[model samples]
Target: MLMDKLREGAQGRGAKIVFWLIILSFSLAGVGSYLNRPADTSPAKVNDQPITAQEFDQAYQSERGRMQQQFGESFAELADNPEYVRQMRQAVLDRLINQLAVDQQAREAKIRIGDQQIKDTIRAMPEFQKDGQFNNELYLNLLSQARLDPNSFSESIRNQLLQQTWASSLTGTDFVLPSEVTLIDKLLQQTRDAQLYTVPVAHFQKTVSVTDAELETYYKANSNQFRSQEQVNVNFVELDAAALAANIKVEDRELRDYYEQHIDQYRTAERRQVAHILISDKDAAVAEKQAETVLTQLKGGADFAALAKEFSSDKLSARNGGELDWFERGVMDPEFEKAAFALSKPGELSAVVKSQFGLHIIKLVGVQPEHERPFDEVKADVLAKLKADKARDLFIDQQQKLSELAFENPDSLDVVSESMGLKLQQSGLMTTSTAKAPFDDAKLKQQAFAENLRDTNANSEVITVGEGKAYVLHILEHKPAMVRPLADVKADVEAAVKLQKAQVEAEKQAATLLSKLNNGEDVSALVKELDVKVESKTGISRTGATLVGTLLNELFRMPHPAADKPVRKLVAMPEGDQVILVLNKVTDTDQPSAAKSMLQTQLAQGRMIASQAALLQQARDAATIEYNPLFNSQPVSE
Candidate 1:
């Protein structure tokens, strides 16, 4: 969906650059240096242009945070998977290298982005605007929330603009051939009808007999698949801010001081409860005349709610007397907000006002003036805030000492746990697939299984489990990988062997049925012999939602059937069922000329994207890249 916005804006250079800025706004680069690693220790280099370790880590952390937010509790399962971590690292590193290559190419080509252009582009962003104009306070607040300083964010924007400019220049103008447009149009208008019958694998299971010798042979060949992963039992000490805050006591004076310092947090913005009778006609004169008539009726003491219900064009609000609900500044149309906020009295009504939405007769129903919360009213909240702040300060100090003590006294976590008032807890045996909290983190799991910890029982350095949480772990027990004996896995192996045999039998039966159908036999006869019903779906497009999975894909792949013969095939379903599909008819509907034009436009945009992708690949292929050995090394606890 974001790609669609980028493609749509790519028509103009300035618009394309602005879209790039919006993209970068969500990246760590746009949010400035959250990672404070030294720039000299580069993790990767693209054509001698180094990508600092800090940049890579910041990007990785940002991506991880995004995934954690998306998946919630399940994110821990993915985080602990070695394959997933490897792929994530490669993806981040590749992105950083690509960016560096693009920047280098842009510089070589003499591409430049002006300061004024950057300023104007940022000001134009809707996120930083209020009341249809740039709001400096809003802009600063947004940057602050993103952890970005103004100067660094602006520089990032400028660099991204330069890269986008180079990309645009390389793509040039994308033109779609008439033949390509015709092909796309034909595909969009194609439809098919098919008859389907399924042969379930369960039916063949009872007929399948797996001998003991066969099961033994299968288990021997696939013994590696049954081997268990290495495991470790860990003893760890954990500290969390929330748990610490629960025991903290806040004095009355502390609460009062916090309340005084953060008074703005308790202040409410001014809001107005306004209602309007809207006459939404495209013709300006007609809408204004209707609004004037409504005003006259209101002045004559006619009920506003009754008139609104009868005449207002805004259907949802008309049912409730045209009530728009409470709103603050910068939320409504410029003309409408001005008229609504200017009415000082509760019963005050504004004259007929013309807005982009047509004409409106506005009434101010009520107002809520800005005010700060009283100390007594917010005392509990203030106390909680003070406690949390104190806990965070205490955690930071304790965490630093804990890290030092854990490293210095590498034999155990006893000293650090006691000094920080933390409890040292033991864990059950954990394998690579362990999804438990704290252990679910890949970095912690890697540390728990490290050779030093497993062989020597050495304590790990302080590891960050999450925000405001850290742990130091030492291995208590180690289990090497081993395969289970045949006797231990005989039942599971027998089931697997029987399932495999059933699949083979089903495929043979499917092939025989297909062969018979290909000859001149009616498909219904075969269905009747199998005692299964055939399902008929008509007028289904390639993208139809009614048919899903492999069956739908098989139907579209079938060629148009002849008058006397239908195309037939066997499709394998995920549930181990085989679908026998007979495509009876294929029809192509004629599209309107407007649809053809739209197709051509889409094809051209797709071509432009492809061209840009090719250029980026070319740049990357030409650039020399080197990665630090530490880049792929095991992660160390922080």
Candidate 2:
């Protein structure tokens, strides 16, 4: 319900507000409106705080950027939808509301998260820490790169922790009830031990007699379903890459002049194949200088591989004696690539180059000289470009005729198909779950199987299915709903019945095993009698997709593993059958360092989602939201 509201809000009046506000802000700045205007006029108010037009527009822009990253092409379509913008604004408002609430609560509850605590938390973050250890420089550099000041970032973290403390209090109140556990056990405890029985549907055949009068009656009653929709006949221009290439004409003189002017583009840059070593920044500048001294010795007749094997700090590369694969210009860092490419001959040693990776001494083992192309040699390339240009023009010509003919003449796809030389294909009675045809483009398949298309009746509609090609679809026929004859699906139904029986048998056996265990009978002996293997699991962690196996998602939600609860976890494997785990114990791990490090990522994502929800609720409660009367009056962008 909330998601639906958010979706509606995103597409309604909210989009108009965002668009107009942005335009006005830009226009105001251009004309110096702010200089002559009073500062007190705000767009709206939230919790007694003025929501300035400037602030609202800034928030809208931020939301747009996030939407672009998340939805890409979808965001472009959504941008024109006011309800979508409304929802986005609500999300921003939700965040602000949550932050304010958390700040107030933190103050009231005397929750003081100190700088040292923030430092400890930051150090514990795996992203900032290097090699499983805290490095202050790594922390500073990474935060700065993310455009985040460390103090502000830490303060944000503090606010999150305070909010999480509140959220945990609200949503995570734990309780145990035997009745509830029993019902859960019954629902979840599934097992299979029964033999399957098959009933072949193919063995049964039914003969049906339809009178001519009955056939006529049926056809007349459901004539709309049988009748094909009016198809399209169109002739249009089409533009494509091949047509563009065909139309491009390049003269001999023009090619020669263009080649001369852009000679540098044709000439390949000189390249060097080099191998080098890197040393750790243990003593920062001193270690780098010392490593350079060692590098010089190797360049002056020392074995390059041996020196690398001894001095390189990069373990993976060091094992191969710093033998980095050959790199070209732009592949390596600018300073390193420049130094390497500047070498005139092989086996030449270059001066030390400093990079963020560290200082590197280079040695050239191979050289490739730069070469330029003559204009005459590339004439064929020019001619091919000309043909492609022509093809594009022809395509565009065809497309325009196609759209016009299709739009003008309905119920005549054959005319357009014949003229365009495209074969008409028929689709089977397709549902939304139909598999993509072999010849169908991925985009076409996506459109054909969209939920909207599935519900739509017979109508000739144009859908852009290809990257540049459009399809004028004609829904030809539809099948009416009827209960399938039992003989047709008897085998499938029988197989379903057998699987259900097997599950019943397995559950029955599990109930007996539980009773035996409660009576203090040997659990292992009982399992042996039942001829089932006893599966064991170990070292399950609270964090990560590791150790818990594929069925871990099911287990994590289980209140407790044992306590006679039914936990169906994947049988300790990447891919395996489900094991009905009688949770033996729920153990908490003592990886405080790991937990503290991972806390930021998990808490931040979860809090952001909750904060957005809260913000939307606050905005919805305050505003008299309405859609434009003209909206939904016409078909919108498909």
Best by lDDT: 1
Residue 518 of model 2 has an lDDT of: 49
Segments of candidate 2 deviating more than 4 angstroms: 1-44, 47-397, 421-429, 435-462, 465-467, 480-483, 522-529, 536-638
Q: Assess the local accuracy of residue 585 in candidate 1 as a C-alpha lDDT between 0 and 100.
A: 90
lDDT of 2 by residue, 1-638 (tens): 99998788878887879978999989989789757664454444444555444444444555566666677544555665778765666676555554554556545666666553455566668977667765556677766644456656677788777666654554454343444444334333322111111111111112123344544454455445443332222222222344344446666676566567667656666555677777667578787787778866975789877877887766666687666555446446678778888776766777777765677777777876677776677666655544554555655666676676666656556676777666666665554334334214444444444445335532244544333455655445444445444445444444444444444444555556656544667767646554555545554444444434444555555555445543433232322122454455654422234234344445555666676566435534654433223222322222
lDDT of 1: 0.81
In model 2, what lDDT does residue 248 have? Answer: 62
Stretches off by above 4 angstroms in model 1 are 1-112, 123-149, 165-172, 175-183, 228-237, 255-385, 397-431, 447-462, 472-481, 521-533, 591-601, 615-638
Candidate maximizing TM-score: 1
